[model samples]
Structure formats: C-alpha cells, structure tokens
Target: MGAAQGDDQDEWSFLFGMLMDDATKRGLAHDELYFLSDELLRFSLAYQGYEPLLEAVADGELSRLRFMHEIWRAMPEHFYVDLALKLGAELLAARQ
Candidate 1:
C-alpha cells in the first residue's frame, strides 16, 4: 500500500481497537469485538462516500470521534445492527 493508505489502515486499526476495548468493557466478548472491527473496516473500504471521511482522518483534518460520527451517520442503522448481530452470532456458533 501507498504511504497514505498505510497510514489510513493504521489509524483505522487504532480506532477499531479502541471500539473493541470499549465493547469488551461493556460485557461483550472478544470474538464479537474482532468481528465488529473487521466488518467496520470492510464497510469503510467499500462504502462509496467514505473516501472523504478517510482522507480527512488521514490528513488530520478530522478527529477520530468525528470520523466515527460520520460513519455512524452514513451507515443505515438497521444495516449496522444487522451486521453486528449476524457476525456476532456467526462467531458465537463457531466457538461452540
């Protein structure tokens, strides 16, 4: 990956880590947290309108909170919830 891409990945990974840590503290399991992070990363990459947000984050024009806010606003609520629940269930099933 190019420098900017690498930096974006690093930044996103850090952001996701924070989210996972928070979720874990909230009583969710690590498997769900990992799946959530992976799905969020994939969504950020595939979402068409996410480029500007990514660029802003990479350029330091946006705080991590702002970037996450934009993502939350951009993604449909039902879709996000469905994705989380589906992935969480899949991971739980695999572990059993």
Candidate 2:
C-alpha cells in the first residue's frame, strides 16, 4: 500500500459509488442491486483463483494481472470497462 495504490483504491470506490447510483436511478430493486455488487465481489474472488493462479504466478506461467483479466473476460463489456479502467491503473502501479 503506497500513495498511488491508495489513490487507485479511492478512484475505484468513487467509480463503484457512481455505478450504484446509476443502478438506483434505473430502479433496480435494493436486493437486485445488492446481488449485482455481490456478483462483482464473487468474480473478483474467482479472479484471485484459490491456488492455481498463485502457482501460475510462482511458476512464471501467468501474471497476476493476466489472471485477473481472465476473470474480466467473463464479464459484460460495460462492467468490465468500468472496473478495468480503474483496476488497470492499480495493476499497472503494482507492476512498477
């Protein structure tokens, strides 16, 4: 956790807040909205990939960012772009 990492986290928070606001404006039921958020959290956890991804990273067969993007590949484009725009900044910072 460095300054830029913290900043990226803040940006992600802002973006998700904006997205949830949009969801409310669209009249999504509270439970539906919650489910949407939960799905994202679940997908994020899937991207972290229990053990295989860690092994891949250790073996140099994959980068963590690439593994994360593989999860993003399963998402809707709009959701993916919204997350990726911020997440990419985080991953890029992590790489450096």
Candidate 3:
C-alpha cells in the first residue's frame, strides 16, 4: 500500500516532520504529538503517490475523516484506539 520499498522511508520521514511541525506549532503535549505523528505517518504511508488523496486530507475535505477511518480499519489488527483518543483530545484542546 505504501510506496515502492525504499521510497516509502522518505515519505514516512516527511510525514513525521510535518506532524512534528504541526504539533509544535499547536503547543501539543509530547505524548499527543507522538501519537498524532504516528497516525499521520500511517496515513501518509497508506496514501502514497495519491496526490489528490493527500490534498483532500490536507484540505480537510469531507472524505478525509472517512479516509482516516479506512486507514485505521486497514491497519494491523494490533492497532489500538488509545492513540486516536489521545490525538482527539489534543485536537479538542487545540481548538479551545
């Protein structure tokens, strides 16, 4: 689902950097930042090469949340909701 092998590493790194920048700018806590960063990296990996998908996500298009839900569903069975909840909290705090 990700980019061709090695190319994925760069994409992941870029996504992490984006999340870190966003989290820092939003004054998010360390744990929240890490959780959001990881989730965002997963999204980036899942949407590799789909510039339209990335743009839709960045612009918060209506489907963005659905896309995230799909990514979460498609992720490994071991993935948990705790991280998502934490990120939600951070987002709520940021909006307040």
Candidate 4:
C-alpha cells in the first residue's frame, strides 16, 4: 500500500481503539457506545485536527488504553496560545 493509504488505516485503528476503551471503561451498552462515539468524534476532530474520528479507528499507534487515556489527559477544555505553541514543539519532538 502507499504511504497515504497506510496512514489512513492507522488513523482508523487508533480512533476505534479509543472508542472501545472509553466504552468499556464506562460500561456503555452497544447503543450507548454508538451515541458516545459521535460526541467523541466531534471532540477528537477539534482537538486532534482529525476530522471524522472513525478514520483512526484502526490506528496501530493507539493500541493500549493507556494511549487513549494519555491523549485525553493531555488535552484541556481550552487551549492557551502560548502553552500550545510550546507544546507544539514538544509534540513534534515526541513524535520523532
């Protein structure tokens, strides 16, 4: 597969894993999980720059529950411009 296609697959995996982690922790029923996933998709899009969070439902990078938790913990309700700028650098470094 091409790099772009691979990246899309990875993103999908990650999003799905996150949804499952949240659903399991909250003891969500199947229908509830579907509803909650929609809410989370909005938040994930605005926070992570990923539209349609389902695209990352299969992301390999987000394998463990810890990864999902960490991502949530790292985000705040509102971003501070200065802090975000600094954290952007840190994020780039961490990704490497």
- Winning candidate number (lDDT): 1
Q: What 10-residue stretch in candidate 3 is worst by lDDT?
A: 69-78
Residue by residue across 1-96, what tens digits does model 4's lDDT show? 347553243455466567776777889743355444445555554664433223444463332333333344433334555688889999999999
Per-residue CA lDDT of candidate 2, range 2-30, in tens?
47553243444455555556656888743
Give Cα distance to truth, residue 19, candidate 4, Å.
0.4
Candidate ordering by lDDT (highest first): 1, 2, 4, 3
**Model 4: how large is the Cα RMSD against the reference?**
13.9
RMSD of 1: 15.1
Candidate 4 structure lDDT: 0.50
Task: Give the alpha carbon lDDT tens digit for every residue of 1-96 in model 1.
Answer: 346553254455566567756766888654444443444534664652466676775686854444554564444445567899999999999999
User: Residue 67's C-alpha lDDT in candidate 2?
Assistant: 38
Q: Model 4, which residues run further than 4 Å from truth?
A: 1-7, 35-96
The per-residue C-alpha lDDT of model 2 at residue 19 equals 53
How much lDDT does candidate 1 score?
Answer: 0.58
lDDT scores in order: 0.58, 0.51, 0.49, 0.50
Candidate 3 residues 1-96, lDDT tens each?
364543344444455556556766888743354544436645554644334544665675624333333343333322336568788999999999
Error in Å for residue 5 of model 1:
30
Q: How many angstroms is residue 20 displaced in model 4 relative to the true structure, after the best TM-score fit?
A: 0.8
**Model 4 worst lDDT run, 10 consecutive residues:** 61-70
Q: Model 3: what TM-score? A: 0.30
Q: Local error of candidate 1 at 36, Å?
A: 12
